[model samples]
Target: MEQRLASPLLQISGLTRHFGGLPALDQVSFQVAEGRVTALIGPNGAGKTTLINCLSGVLEPDSGTIIFQDRDITGLSPHQVARLGIARTFQNLRIFPRMSVLDNVLCGLTVQAGGSLLEALLRTPGLRHRERRLKLTALEALDSFGLGDKAGWPAGALSYGDKKRVEMARAFVSQPVLILLDEPVAGLNPEETAQIAALIRQMRVYGKTMLLVEHDMDLVMGVSDHVVVLDGGCRIAQGPPDEIQVNPLVLEAYLGRMSATA
Candidate 1:
């Protein structure tokens, strides 16, 4: 379990988003503690993806404030959010199929890249130095994810689990303060899921905060310090993993029936 900090690293307040007449996120509020792993688990159509999109600036909330490190970042573009030390992986693999594995991870460092476009075009010494440094860093990240041997291969040629690892390595390559993982283990087999789970814990050890959106209950409960449950675009229950497991509302949301004792 992660130790909670005095102040939250990210705060969402009164966040709401609507699609035409339907609400995707309804007055959602949550606090993500620094250096902790928080799991957002909910049934289908629960607005989890919508929330991620809004936070990452893929979509703007109709009304709300997103405070990161005490700065209001609501509606900032995706690159803007990433520059503020936030990185994320998609529910759908966003890997560049035609690119070499190393190049795919290199894309994540664009936010950190320095030197003017003219310098890059001229292949200045500074630009070349930065490029070499980035490649080494990307290779290290791939090694950490057990993909070093495959770094030269096309990302599309890898197995499904390997592709997921590549995406994750890309997200971590920049060492963001927070990572949002959407359905990280969705299509993995047991061994692959276990590997991802271990990697998640390893990231925590490296002092990374993670907000995970996943349907895998075992993985969620196993690695999360806190869990938030949403249903039909509304937050129903939130607490520590153990408490969330026994939460009546959570059970009802997932099972579509109330507990016998409830």
Candidate 2:
């Protein structure tokens, strides 16, 4: 069955990035439809991470354009991108081990935290009210991710699975329009993988647009409404998951390797 994609929320046209004269992303282009899960899949070194970095403004593209919400955002900074309603999680966990879970989630609110320095210094009534409201919102986010009880615990004290949930809660706390998830299920057990897959679906149900780079074919096929395949830093195939799964290029470049390794 063909998947019906929503209107395009993000458009990448001729996005190229290089490291040391080698193209990490060579003219890659794709559209992420609004309110859908778009999976970017390829073998390692296929520019998946580079594309994600470029979209999230961690690295500027050497050439090409990135359009978000119909705005030209090609070279925006990470904070600028975040303030414009895009949030991302890292391939490697970026949690603050020493900080409390609630504090860690609060970090995401910086994009929405608006106040003058003098107002904060004086702790005005409005500032206090806003702070309280933000804290409540953070607590609600934790509760949604099933970490409400551990909100006061040191982030490092949680188990690996719980830590992953904490990262998810923090990334989503700010309620960004688009979420970039990079290898969201890396190093998880089967149970944890299933949990994360369900969470991904839940996010879509709530109307969050997502673009994820992942190697877990099962999770990708299970949750993705649209799939884009990249190989050697170029887009090779893209479409519904069923079509992408049988694509000759994808089979030769991605799944064939998994079959051989297994």
Candidate 3:
């Protein structure tokens, strides 16, 4: 089924996380609208990745409630969250180094329903059919990211830029309703960053909801439909990209002073 862009699908309320007495996220709240690209932007230590970790179930929050599709999903395990149709890419690459790029992507399709272990051991008709379909889907996902030719190569042998794209393809293979992108464009050159930004925009055209945590201001402003700013573990501003660009508080927190770009 196709999702519409006119409604809110994820609501985060009073989300907070602490690490050894230091508050990484404090009372953070936001709504991710269906079918929109939402970027989470802030300074180096503003809790962006911590918030993402909480959302993707890599870390449990100290206090908060996460509502997705009208259900409270706070504190769910990573596997539980993935089964609920949320996919994520981490700040560090999570690829299987020795595996083929195609196989790395195919791993994401584990969510695709297959028969039980016993049935698979017997090569049941249903499981075979599902596995074949999943392979085709995984290949298509790699091709869409411009990495089809490298599908047979070792994932660890690729350049950093290509590795990032592979990670993205893996997350995208799950076909989730929401994608949590943690620093998708970090440490890339200008050309690489531009390519990724374009891919994100393409995903947006297809109505995939994205919550991206990126340090690249240009990419964030160019690809995001909405921007949320965090400072000292608190949400300081949020709105359309243009509005956030001019927000005084955002300028001060992100750049240490007011600037035209905020």
The number of the candidate with the highest lDDT is 1
Off by over 4 Å in 3: 1-6, 112-129, 257-262
Global lDDT of model 3: 0.86
lDDT per residue for candidate 1 within 8-122, as digits (tens), equals 9999888999999899899988889999999999887889999999999999999999999999999998878888889899999998898899988887765546333344345
Output the lDDT of residue 246, model 2: 87
TM-score of each: 0.91, 0.91, 0.90
**Candidate 3, 1-262: lDDT as tens digits:** 1223355799898999999899999999888998989999988888999999899888999998999998899999877788888989989888888988987787777642422334533556765667787889989999999999999999999999999999999899879989999999898899999999999999999899999998777899999988988888998888889888888888788878324334
Q: Candidate 2 at 243: error in angstroms?
A: 0.9
Please give the TM-score that candidate 1 achieves against the real structure. 0.91
For model 1, name the residue pairs that clash: none
Q: Which segments of candidate 2 are over 4 A away from where they belong? A: 1-6, 114-129, 259-262
Clashes of each: 0, 0, 0
- Residue-by-residue lDDT tens digits, candidate 2, 186-253: 98999999998988899999999999889999899999989998988999889999999888889998
lDDT value, candidate 2, whole model: 0.87
